[model samples]
Target: MRLRSLTLACSLTALTLGPVAHAAPHSGHRDATTAASAADKKPRPDDTIIAVVNSIPLTTRDVENRGKLFALSTGLPVSGELMDRLRPQIIRQLIDERLRTQEILSRHINTPPEQIAAAIAGIERRNGMPQNALRDRLAQDGVSLTTLIDQIRVQIGWVQVLRQELGARGRVSAKEIAQREDALKRQDGRTEYNLSEIFVKVEDPRHSEDELSFTNTIIQELRKGAPFPIVAAQFSQSQTALDGGSMGWVQEDELDPAVISMVKQMPVGAGAISNPIKVPGGFVIITVNGKRVIGHQPGHVITIRQAFLPFDAPLNPEHVTPQQQQTLQKAVKIAQTVNSCEAVAAINQQNGEKRPSDPGELQLERMNPQMRSLLEGLPLNKVSRPLVSTDGIDLIMVCSKKEKNFADRSPSEIADQLMNERVEQTARQLDSDLHRKAMIDMRIKLKGV
Candidate 1:
């Protein structure tokens, strides 16, 4: 199965599948290693059946292992209270996974084993763990590697199923692409929101209150610092759930009026969660990640060269090692003498720093105030004073600066956006159809004890 690796704090824009294989504990939570040790002390009987999907038995051990996986991924403690809160959602997610996997297998779909291995490798890379480390970590947390692998397999297979269902309908023609481009050009100066969503579909109007209560519980968990993407993957019924609920950048006009109103009031920089905005067939909890005025804001894109000097160990401000002191002295001298970006590169190469000489173009507005202020008015070909941190010291030289219009998206960008919209619509339709046709037996109670 071709799986995209999941990150601890996943990109709010990408479609990533799989659990956070190597997440560290968040602040106010138990250390991940300690939590894993505690889980290892308690083991469940493997043969206890919790639920059955199309005659496929799901064991209590399966539920418990998946629960630990969720805790690890979201940085939530695996305490009794937390487990009790998560059990229903975990069961629902497992059921959906089973349904999707069974459908893919019925059609005889095959995902290459190498692709699955590559996805696992990607998980390790993103987590900065060594090869084969994911399996060891899962074992430490009392979760079998199989629990994660099975989920990845389902995700990969389901994607193929969606593509097959889309067939030719997924493609956007040149005329359609042009129409979208023209439309965007006409509305060039409007506002657009960078948004993420968690959509809970109201299957039965009579049960709307139940759905609302369930969504509220998810919101409570999110407020308690559970990672939003992981929660979305586990509980959101929207097509974009696999993508961590990212809707990319969308104009306010493209969304429902209720959602647009919510986005209008949200602030920039940090994400703001909205009250459940009732839409046609569902209630959506929106998070406005950011907002920008189209075609008006000119961002300063700058290219710079940096020479870094590192110490053998982390530098302590109160007690500096002689080696660190010597490195800082060298950095200062280089900053004073370097007259050109080329000289900065040569200095870095000569010192064997191994850092990139050119770290590519960066948006000036996105930088921290200290670095931005230092370089904002700096003339090209001049180096700044040494910027010291715990890891190392850096002397940066401005290479070039240019103003780029953020709203002037190219035709390819427009085409991609159109394709995403089509895919989302198709996915929702197919998912609903699957739910309608599948023989799902809910033997386990998902509500209150």
Candidate 2:
């Protein structure tokens, strides 16, 4: 009887190991006994022949193909450990999805097919890819269009379910909105801080038991005085992680509400650490180092400039044919010869038929990196290098620079910013709470991926 029970349990378990699955049984957690008896045989992922979700069979083809898809998309080295971490998160996610799908069906909520198609199209466009390009990208990550479609269906269906399950009739009182508005008005000229932080990225929403436990352990270590920079280097998912995740002191309003609330409650010299901040993939552990005030001065006469490259985008050196290289050279030539910011603007417009005037405000404190570095040690009226901005080759002329004075920030202004921050923090906590509680048969493990 136990043998048959174990076999049946294993079959059901595979469903939870949807894409890349992992399972290790340990004592003292809910479902621990069940996990031990069923998972003791420890079937290798490939050996797990079939997955049954609510008695519905899911073929190995689905899981393997999905795994291949995930691997191709990320382009990261897929070590044994990576696979082990990927499995449980993927499986649980799929299980939740299956459950969500059933609820949607039971509610009889309909997601217009056209709406789903439009949404998918918008996603592709935002990624700057053609329809076929999206498919190619997915294929590169080992994903099939079919897989994407299925995922989208599940998501759209969920939206329908949410609309039906949670009615949107709830309203924020006028007094609440007025209070929030006052909170907003208070932020003007208020001191923003300059600080550095290490943010450990949480990428997987449905974490494997091992991965969850591992991250929790890391978070614990971080809470216990681990150096922010060192810990970030080891675990943060941000590109800035290489530099200890130093994006510099973020504006209070710019931080994740949870992070900001935690910081607000602490003193200046004090650093606050969070229990993993969840993301679509995993968790982010943030440790703040410091903060400063930020603002733009009206006397801060700023000149913003950039060279345009029109539709004549650069050549892909990797696969550039001679003709493509020639076209790119012309664009580069036009960009290199522009002598001054004004000249660049004129030339940018000279090709009236070539590229439109792409201009933006020049905020000294918000200038791009290269310009910020170049102007840092130099005095006023400095002509910066052709800094690469989002538009094109750029240079800046700081008309003036002045110290931020208290006259710019009135008490009401200060109070408003502080209050909005307070409200935002509350809203964020509520959001996290709702998400955490929404899971079914959810297992949270607090030890190694």
Candidate 3:
């Protein structure tokens, strides 16, 4: 699979699976690693079974591992009390995963080792962790890397199941694309929001209280500087978890009635997490990235080629290092000699490409005033003087600049959106059907979890 597809799939897969728990001690609670070790030292003949799905047993050890994983992923303190509170949701998630895994095997879906490796790699890349660092992190926490790999296998296979179920409906025709485009065009002055969300599902009405408690804990972590995307990937029930809970741009009418007023009132740039808003299935936590008038906002889309030279140390205005001086001189020479974007790219390659030569299409209006002012007057193909920063100096060449409506959606994007919607619907339906047919036996009380 392509890296982007795998990255998206990796996030989608961990929606219900918690990372492996760390054994580290936290103040004011019984140590998780110690507790696990104590249990291991017990005279029990075999690991106690907690649940059974399709005649396959899930053990107390499994529950502990999942609970610990949840704690590790959320930065929550690991304690027996916390595990007790998390038990119900953890078991429910495990049950759903078991059902999905069973379905995957029945369908004979194959997720090769390479694909799983790629997914793991993608996870590290997104979280800014280095190669093999995930495995190392899990190991240090006293958990096996297999804990994550198994979850990814199920998620990748489940995606295939949904695609297979979708059949021809997965393909969106030109007519449908045209219809969506027309609808959006008609919405021209109406406001639309760019939102990200985390959906905590309440599977049974009787257990709503437990789910709400879980949701609140998640919100607390989010507000305390935990990464939203990572949290959503691990906990959200919505399919948008695949895209880090991104809902993309949606009009007010598209949101739940309860969410509309809240989103409308939210100030942009607050990065404020919403309270648990009751929705059709469960509670939804949302954050607004931005809001704009539909099809009305217009701005220039600019593409530039840049050559960046790095300094061995951070630049100091009062005490410049020799390396910094040499880097500036190199930047000046490249800027003076470079006549085209290709030439700039070549220079960047020669400098070991410390930075990307092409920074993709940038919205000119979104840039800071200083950068915007410099670019507005910059002529095409002429390299600008060095743009100094603490780490490096950049020589820029604007390759293309043009005005366009930012709100417009391309046909391919529309098609993907429609497909994702259909897949999400199919997933919920299939999950419900699996639960309806499966015989799951809970042995939680007997296992004392």
**Top TM-score model:** 1
Compared with the true structure, what per-residue lDDT tens digits does model 2 show for residues 115-184?
Answer: 6566555544333334655566556555566765665576556544433433432223446556645654
Stretches > 4 Å off in candidate 3 = 1-48, 60-87, 123-133, 304-399, 445-449
| Per-prediction tally of clashes | 0, 32, 2
Cα deviation at 25, candidate 2, in Å, is 21
- The sequence of per-residue lDDT tens digits that candidate 3 reaches over residues 1-449 is 11113234444333223443324221111112233345434533436876898898887666667666656665556776566555555666678889999998898899999999998776664443447877887777655677677777877888887777888786888899899889888888999998899887766665566567667766776777656776676567787776678877888988899998788777765679898898988889999987889877788988999887767776889999989988888888877877999999988777667566787999887787899998888999999989998767889999888999878888877777777777778878998899899998865332211
Local distance difference test values of all predictions, in order: 0.70, 0.44, 0.72
Scored by lDDT, model 2 comes in at 0.44
Higher-lDDT candidate of 1 and 3: 3
> Which regions in candidate 1 have their CA more than 4 angstroms from the true location?
1-46, 302-362, 367-400, 447-449
- Model 3, TM vs. native: 0.74
**What is the descending TM-score order?**
1, 3, 2
lDDT for model 1 comes to 0.70
Ranking by lDDT: 3, 1, 2
**2 or 3: which has the higher TM-score?**
3
TM-score of model number 2: 0.47
